[model samples]
Target: LDRRSTFAAEVCGCQVEIGAAGAMGAAAVVEAAGGTALQACDAAATVFQNIMGSVCDLVQGIVEIPCHSRNAALASMAFLCADM
Candidate 1:
């Protein structure tokens, strides 16, 4: 987690001039699951894409629909894929 957070912060700082929001927590979990920094990032992007694919801005409000669960599943799958 710590390493991820640092890497995220560094990336954000270098790229966008802003501090990272959830990079640390994300990084920690990925690292704990035995992912390298590059792999973790790729996995994260896959997870994000999976979630975003199902998200919708409804007439009443923004809704995730099936994206949240899908993202979680995809994240795990991505981690496994990265390992391989």
Candidate 2:
């Protein structure tokens, strides 16, 4: 357990979300930080529109191929969406 790290984010994504969780969580954070719900939904929808994880991406029971980059990229994308 010590090997894993912890974060202090406003909200966190879950395993069920797979690919777009980061962006969605980021949107939630923005909303929690005073952004409107519409903004958050727009941000999450934007990120989801860009990239979405799928079961087809799984390989050998591992879904690590693009999740790392996808999550990071999408998380940042949410901010742009919220701003717009």
Candidate 3:
């Protein structure tokens, strides 16, 4: 929940869950799955950095157009980050 992310959401607020909030949840999942705290944090930070932007403009009131792809990509990425 940094200003840049908040601003990105405010500027193009569509799927709030698919953004920083999603990454935060991903981190907790990593930690719960026996990942180290640092790993969890790294996963979350990397996810946040990867998807961080006012890119919610792609979510034009639907899930088919890039939203689903973004979610899948990030969800998969969280595990990779944890492993790394």
Candidate 4:
């Protein structure tokens, strides 16, 4: 139970940190591109949605199955979002 709790905390922390960083980066890009507040926020929303955590409990509870692909997907999504 403690391990699960710790995992949950780590997941929550990543969500907050990555989401905020992406949002801020999106906003900055939008501003630099001469976009309005609404546009910036919309871009940030797209980023946030894309960067949300992926499922990490696949393959009969085997840890590696989910860890690699899930984290890779998250990183790719973040890059794609930033490019958008």
Candidate 5:
């Protein structure tokens, strides 16, 4: 998450906090479920691919608008991955 936040800030100029949490947490859950390293990474990458740019760039440019809900959805994904 730290690396992702740094890279996104330096390169993409965005926070991407929830995204990092969702992807990394999902990967951790997959690995905890006995998946191979590659499989875990793939699952996390799939989650990122699905949600990376979904609700960002809102007209208001404040995180409170869509970010909270997006974070909730990401948290749900994390729990779902854990369950799997």
Candidate 6:
């Protein structure tokens, strides 16, 4: 039980860190493309929604499952959003 709880916490923390990194990436991209950071962030959010497609929350309480993939996807999306 303790290990499970720790895993959950770690997963949650990773998710939060991913979000922050995504935001920063988006800002950088937007700045590079001559767009506003807010607009880039909005685009990133849309990209996230499309990529995740209603699949929210981790299943089996495993962080390595969707969390890892989503984090990577988010980083890519941030770059794409900034370019657009």
Best-fitting candidate, scored by lDDT? 5
Worst 10 residues of 3 by lDDT: 5-14
lDDT of 2 by residue, 1-84 (tens): 113422322133222343345556758777878987777877767666655333334556655654565566666766666666
Question: Please, what is the TM-score per model?
Answer: 0.36, 0.50, 0.61, 0.53, 0.66, 0.51
Error of 3 at 5 (Å): 4.5
Q: Write candidate 5's Cα lDDT for 1-84 as tens digits.
A: 464345453353333666677878888888878888887777677667767666355556664666677778888887575455
Candidate 4, 1-84: lDDT as tens digits: 134333252556444455556666777777887878887888778877765664345579665565556455555554455457
**What is candidate 1's lDDT per residue for 1-84, written digit by digit as tens?**
245444342333321111122233345567888778986676555444433323233434533433344445554655454444
Model 3 Cα lDDT, one tens digit per residue, 1-84: 655445353455534556665577668778888988887888888776777663654555764567677777777776666556
What's the lDDT for all of these models?
0.43, 0.56, 0.67, 0.60, 0.67, 0.62
Model 2 Cα shift for residue 9 (angstroms): 23
For this target, which candidate reaches the highest TM-score against the unseen true structure? 5
Measure candidate 5: CA RMSD. 3.6
Model 3 lDDT, residue 70, Cα: 71
Give the total clashing residue pairs for model 6.
Answer: 0
Distance (Å) between predicted and true CA of 5, model 4? 17
lDDT: worst 10-residue window of model 2? 1-10
User: Residue 12, candidate 1: how far off, in angstroms?
Assistant: 20
lDDT of 3 at 30: 85
